[model samples]
Structures are given as structure tokens and as C-alpha cells.
Target: MKLLLTSGGITNDSIHAALEDLLGMPVGEADALVVPTAQWGHPMCGPASVRGLVAATPSFRHFTALPWASLGVLELTALPTVGKDRWVPWVEAADVLLVDGGDATYLAHWLRESGLAALLPELHGTVWVGMSAGSMALTPRIGQDFVEWAGAPDDRTLGVVDFSIFPHLGAFPGNSLEHAERWAADLDNPAYALDEQSALTVVDGVVDVVSEGEWHLLRS
Candidate 1:
């Protein structure tokens, strides 16, 4: 599996280069299925937000949002049983899957509920790109600080990656490097704290950190 997990989407030259390397082609030639399902519980989660995100990463040949929320089922098991003709084909056709930031729990719930988690393994060359909450949801578990911050009911995640990510390190309002460090210090599993200009790239089972700003890894 190939993944570009970021605090913010392709925000700088280094990150852009990393993405290009992963794609093995200019981003303009690639198509993406943007999953903004994580933004469901936020007030700013709307068409404009999605548009702005797409605009920032102008390389995609096409960027479209998957309407997972429209289905309305709360349980993860309901997704595979229901037919998702509107988005499934688009997901299959895209070269990348772009996930935006919001509440990690909310995002994970929909990803599993929409059957995207199961379908991911079948997407051989499709790059999984995640930003902020999108990045966090792919971890084995959500860190305590994040669960408390979001008031999320559970810390469970998709477990697509072994380590947990703490995004927007020293970049988010009210968050600082100290706060991230404290959180990482308490985690039993491997953890990473990433700023806006940093990303965690994972290929097969190897992990690499690409950054233009600040980042750190914590392991015990």
C-alpha cells in the first residue's frame, strides 16, 4: 500500500515532490476521489471547503467528493450491504483517494460504513492521501489527546497503518509542540507529530518522513 499522510494537503514543494514521486507522474495527469466524509460534523464542511482543497492541489485531472453522508446509516456494517453506484465507480476509476480533515471518529465511521476501507486493498495502484483527521483515521488507534479534543466516543481507527499520527503540530490554534510531545509520550504504540509542512509516507511496510517544517517520531 502507498500512503501520503499529511497535517495539511500537499502544502509545500517537498510534499508536492513526494506526492509526484508516489504517483510516478505529474499530478495533473492523475484523477482523484476526494472523501470529505470526515467533515460531516463540522460547520465549515461544505462545497466551498471541498472546492478550496481541490484548488490548492491543482495537479489532479479531476477532483470529486464522494457523497457518503447522503446514505445516512450510522453503523459500519451497513455500507457493503447497500449499493453505492454513484461513488464506487468513480473511486475505482481514480488514481488517488484524497481524504480531507475533520473529526477522526466521524471520518472512520463513514469510511467503514461506506465500504471504502474494504475496497482499498483492491485498489492496487491507487495512492491513499490523507490530511489531518484523514491522516489520523488510518492509524491503529487515535491518541488520547485527540479523542478528548474531539470528544470522540472511541479511539478505534481503520488500522491501515501501525502508528498513530498527531497532526497540525504547533500549527493548529491552541496546539503546541509541547502538547504534541506530551501526547506522544503517553502513547504505548509508535506515534508521530507532524506540522503543516510535514508528511508521513508509507510504502509496503517501510515508513519515511518528508517535511519542510517540524516533525518527530515517538517509540518505546
Candidate 2:
């Protein structure tokens, strides 16, 4: 699978182009399935936040608002109960998975529990577009600073890539450069700090950063 890990959504032209490159076609020609399971794990997100994301409301214009050939919701929490016969095809048919943000640990749990994580190896053509915690879910760790879910056992995640991420750089209070430095120091591994306009694309085994705004490779 191709990875477009982001702190925010496709908020700039470069990121949008990167998304197209990953899709091998225009976004309008690609079918998309949105994973909103992460939203359920955060205290700041709930019915309203999920609704905004699903509805492509103004606040979420950066994401679901992109013109997709078709759009559908894929609640990971519900996938386990529905059985693979019903949901596997839905996942396989989509060109990309638009994973929204929230709590990485909680999202990791459902991804594994729903069998989605196990299925990733088969989706060689699928592009994974992740935002915030959505992006973090693929990393080895998100660091303690970003843990917002009370139920998470730890900051560890899927580690699909060999690094960590410090998201929302300078966008939110307490998420300034100083905070990212501390976060990266504690991580003691390869890491990046992405502003809203920044994104990291991984294809095969190579990684590239695409940004129109600030981004920092805190650790090599």
C-alpha cells in the first residue's frame, strides 16, 4: 500500500498532487472509503465531530470535500461484527482509505481487531491517506505528548514505517516547535513535525516530504 501520512488533510496543492500520484488517477476517478473510527476514541470528538467529517462539513473541507467518484463510510468498529463477506470487498474496491484523526492507539486497536490491519498486505494498489492520529496509527510510537485516549495502554502504534510523528505543529496551543523538540527527544527515533500544509509520502520503501508550509525532521 502507498502511504500519505499527514498532520492535516490535503490542505495544499502539493499534497493534492501527491495524492493523485498515489492514486494513479484524479481523485474524482477514485472511489474512497472513510474510516472514522479514530474519532470515537477521543474526548474532544463524538457524534458532532464524526458527523462533520462524514458530511464533509465546512470544518472538514480539507478532507471529505475532495471530489470523489463515490464516498462511503467504513466504521472500523463495526467491521468485526459485520463479517469479511460484507466489508472486505468494500475495502478492496476502494482506491484509497481516507483515515481521519483522533486517538492513534484506539484506532490501532480497531484496525487490528477488525482484521483490516491483517489485510493491508494484500492491498498493494490502495493508497492510505491519513490525518493527524490517522497518520500516527502507522508509526512505531506517537509519544506521550499526543496521547489523549484514557483507554490506551501506551503510545505505541502499528509501526508500519520505522519512525514517529509529531503532528499539528504550531497549529494548536502547546504544539509549538519547543513541544515537538521535546516530543522528538523522548522518542529517540526518526521523527517529523508537520504543519498543516505538510505531508510525508511513502512508496515502496522510500519516503518523501511534501510541504508548502513548515516541516522539520527532528531526528534522522
TM-score of each: 0.81, 0.98
Tens digit per residue, CA lDDT, model 1, 48-120 = 7655555543432222322212111122334467577755676677777777777787788778777788888
Give stretches of model 1 more than 4 Å off. Answer: 43-86, 148-152
The residue-level lDDT of candidate 2 at 12 comes to 92
Estimate the lDDT of model 1.
0.73
Q: What are the lDDT scores of the predictions, listed in order?
A: 0.73, 0.93
Residue 147 shift from truth in candidate 1, angstroms = 3.3
Least lDDT summed over 10 consecutive residues: which range in candidate 1? 65-74
User: Which residue pairs overlap in candidate 2's backbone?
Assistant: none
Q: For candidate 2, lDDT tens digit of each residue in 38-113?
A: 9889999999999999998889888898899998999999988889999999999999999999999999999999
